[model samples]
Target: MRRIFLVYALVLVLLSPAFSFAAGWRDGTYEGWSDAGPRSIQYAKVFIQDGEIAGVILREYTDRLVEKDWTCYDYPPFGEAARTLGTKFVEAQLAEIDAYTGATGSSTGWMQAVERALKKAGDAKKEKQYFDGTFLGRSEVADRGYYEVVWVTVENDKITGLQVQRVLADLSVLDPDTYEGFPLEMARQAYAQELIGRDNADVDAISGATGLMNMLNIAVRDALDRASTK
Candidate 1:
């Protein structure tokens, strides 16, 4: 009986690491985005359940906020990459994997997005008070029939970076450099200055752009909520 008890204890010790590693993920859906290039932004939505990756949805959108139609003839490689990489990540349970040969760029972006999502889903009790990652959030459509999206970056529990985008009803992104976008540009700059380095969205609204400011506040708060450990 003493020998049998010692053997059982040894087995438990051998399996403990794997058990802890598997329990390091919190079950939830998390969304992340890659840095926006001049032409596009990559997005990943990861679903986790029972501490395992359940599914991944990958998407790329043009600079104008239009989703890329990977099914089109010109984008076959991207379509293939998107279809395969998600399954590969789900199977391997890791984001670092072999990239598709002809679609390396898309594969890299998707991988990065997935990595960020997993970071957000890290076990809260075992990790930092706030996840260090990029989180995306959006505001409900306002009375003007437009909405706002903001990407908030957190590092060391501080809001390190922010990018805001406004989408029109037609799905076109507002060009902040244009004359028509002057007000939005002003509001973006003001709110970014106010919110960066702060953990909360308790900044004051910008005058003359009250509606846009409200949308910005809503979006930022949504993002902070996702980044919170509590």
Candidate 2:
């Protein structure tokens, strides 16, 4: 009777789903908590078997910041959010995912954690694509070129990312000091948000930042032109 019971227990344990996850998780929900400022953010992260970060949604929040001085006060730190929210099963390089506008604090916080996880899983690699960082269109020495900085990234023959650094004539709009810590990072984010999952030449320009859009158009055109030449 004892031998039969032991055999039955072994069979049940071997058949359990948790045991299968010991090999690998097909999908997992990673929970993250952050303390960047006054509020604590809780994250519910979802990922695929390939190690690509599929998606993440904020599961809970405590002390959500209210906007007043152009910045969200008391937001969570990016690293904590990233660590708490990222999964452990990814195996390929990762693309930077979009963060919600106006929630820059939370977005960056979660991104930091996500990036760490991707690195640990060996899914993301560094590459100098068309849009790795900030780029300025230079035609003259006298020009500060702040009005038209374009950010773009390409992968797999597709423009995977974009951003306009400064569109507002008033520098204060992009200034952290004047804007109360919001770094006018919107131009790039706006561009990136629109370009992701899009695979065409005809991209809709941002209305509020038309000047920046014009500059980005020229930059993207240049990148595409270079690709064609190669």
Candidate 3:
């Protein structure tokens, strides 16, 4: 009987990591990352202070669909999760909150991303600034026939400028009207104006051209992620 009890205890010890999590987290900053694809996966960075979550930041999310032989987005019910979801998570801390509006795939994915960040916060708490330099980011539009390229300048750990380069391919003619006006640069140029002096905190979608902004956000995120790697 004693041997059986000992063997059961050993099994629990071996499986502990699956249940291991920070019941009491220290204050600082923690990042939670998710898989690729803005629709399903979300990357989040959270700041904890005085044992309460102080701030939360999210990368742009994409919603894509194939309609009438074109790639388009099916905007989720709640377009922004940082303010709503983040606020709820911070309020609940370790307790689960009602799905931010609903448990649709996007909302569920957002919740999972937040949980991962919180779980990681216990061990690798960090509050590092962006690596200073200029970097390039690129993301393909899947079937949109163009790529969004952004050159971001970082100085003193903050964004100073953004130069956008729209690369149009032969397939760009799929939407013919102007020679290269399909993926307009004007929206990005305006967005560049908005990015000045902002950290990733302010990288929200441009009001009128949010579609382009969503695509650009992925590329911009890639650039920022690369800077972190180096």
- Please tell me which predicted candidate would have the highest lDDT against the true structure: 1
The order of the candidates by TM-score, greatest first, is: 1, 3, 2
Over the full model, what C-alpha lDDT does candidate 1 score relative to the true structure?
Answer: 0.77
Tens-digit lDDT track of model 2 for 58-113: 33333221122212434434434343333322222232455555556766545544
Number of colliding residue pairs in model 2: 13
Per-residue CA lDDT of model 3 for 115-215, tens digit only, reads 65666555554344554555556666657577776666677767786755555664222222353643465676677777777767245757777767777
In order of listing, the candidates' clash counts read 0, 13, 0
- TM-score, each model? 0.68, 0.29, 0.39
* Reference-based TM-score, model 2: 0.29
Model 3, which residues run further than 4 Å from truth?
1-22, 37-40, 63-76, 80-82, 124-230
Which of the predicted structures, 1 or 2, would earn the higher TM-score when compared with the native? 1
lDDT per residue, candidate 1, 1-230, as tens digits?
99999999988977763353743778999886665555666788989988888899999877544588787838678889877788888887887889999988878878887877887787644355556777666788977777898888889888888888878888777777773744667778888998889888777867777777788888878777666654
| Local accuracy by lDDT, each model | 0.77, 0.42, 0.57
Off by over 4 Å in 1: 1-55, 61-69, 117-126, 129-136, 175-184, 225-230
Per-residue lDDT value at 3 in model 1: 100
State which candidate, 2 or 3, has the greater TM-score: 3
